[model samples]
Target: AQSVTQPDIHITVSEGASLELRCNYSYGATPYLFWYVQSPGQGLQLLLKYFSGDTLVQGIKGFEAEFKRSQSSFNLRKPSVHWSDAAEYFCAVGARDILTGGGNKLTFGTGTQLKVEL
Candidate 1:
């Protein structure tokens, strides 16, 4: 069984400030990791993913994450955040489950609500 846990339920950041969001997961094997951001009344958009290659993966919208196998963590970071970046962020993991129909199923964390101020 695989599961994801995001420590912070909500976060606030000033415009142009650095940001970091923590994520932890539990899985038998190294699963496919992903980070997604969702705006109000919108679907999730992929930020980045960790499959097999690099430990650190860069994402769209000036975001990046590092996969730490030992710590079972994948934390998202941005050098500077914009006000438009205020939204809900979710950390997800792709794992094979009998309930899923062949395609990868994403197990998402509770979600981290981001609030960016001017």
Candidate 2:
């Protein structure tokens, strides 16, 4: 079974400062990783993903993540953050469950809340 862990439950950053959110996974083989962001009343939006090929992946909203197999990490980073960026961020890993007829599913972290200061 695969799982994800987000070390920090909450993080605060200055409006224009840089930011990085940690995401670590426990999986046997090559894992499919993703980063998503959700606002107060909005659904999860895909930030970035790593399936294969390039280790460094770029995503929407000026976000990017690098997949590090050696470290078992896929950390999200942004050069600068806006006030609107303050939201709940999630790290997820896609896995297949044979118990469920070999269907694909995602294991998500508890999430990390971002609070931006002006």
What lDDT is reached at residue 63 by model 2? 95
Candidate 2 lDDT for residue 7: 99
- Model 2, residue 19: displacement in angstroms? 0.2
Error of 1 at 85 (Å): 0.3
Model 2: per-residue Cα lDDT at residue 46: 90
Candidate 2, residues 4-95, lDDT tens digits: the string is 99999999999999999999999888888999999999999999888889999999999999999999999999999999999999999996
Q: What lDDT is reached at residue 81 by model 2?
A: 94
Q: Each model's number of backbone clashes?
A: 0, 0
TM-score of 1: 0.93
Off by over 4 Å in 1: 96-102
lDDT of 2 at 31: 88
Best by lDDT: 2
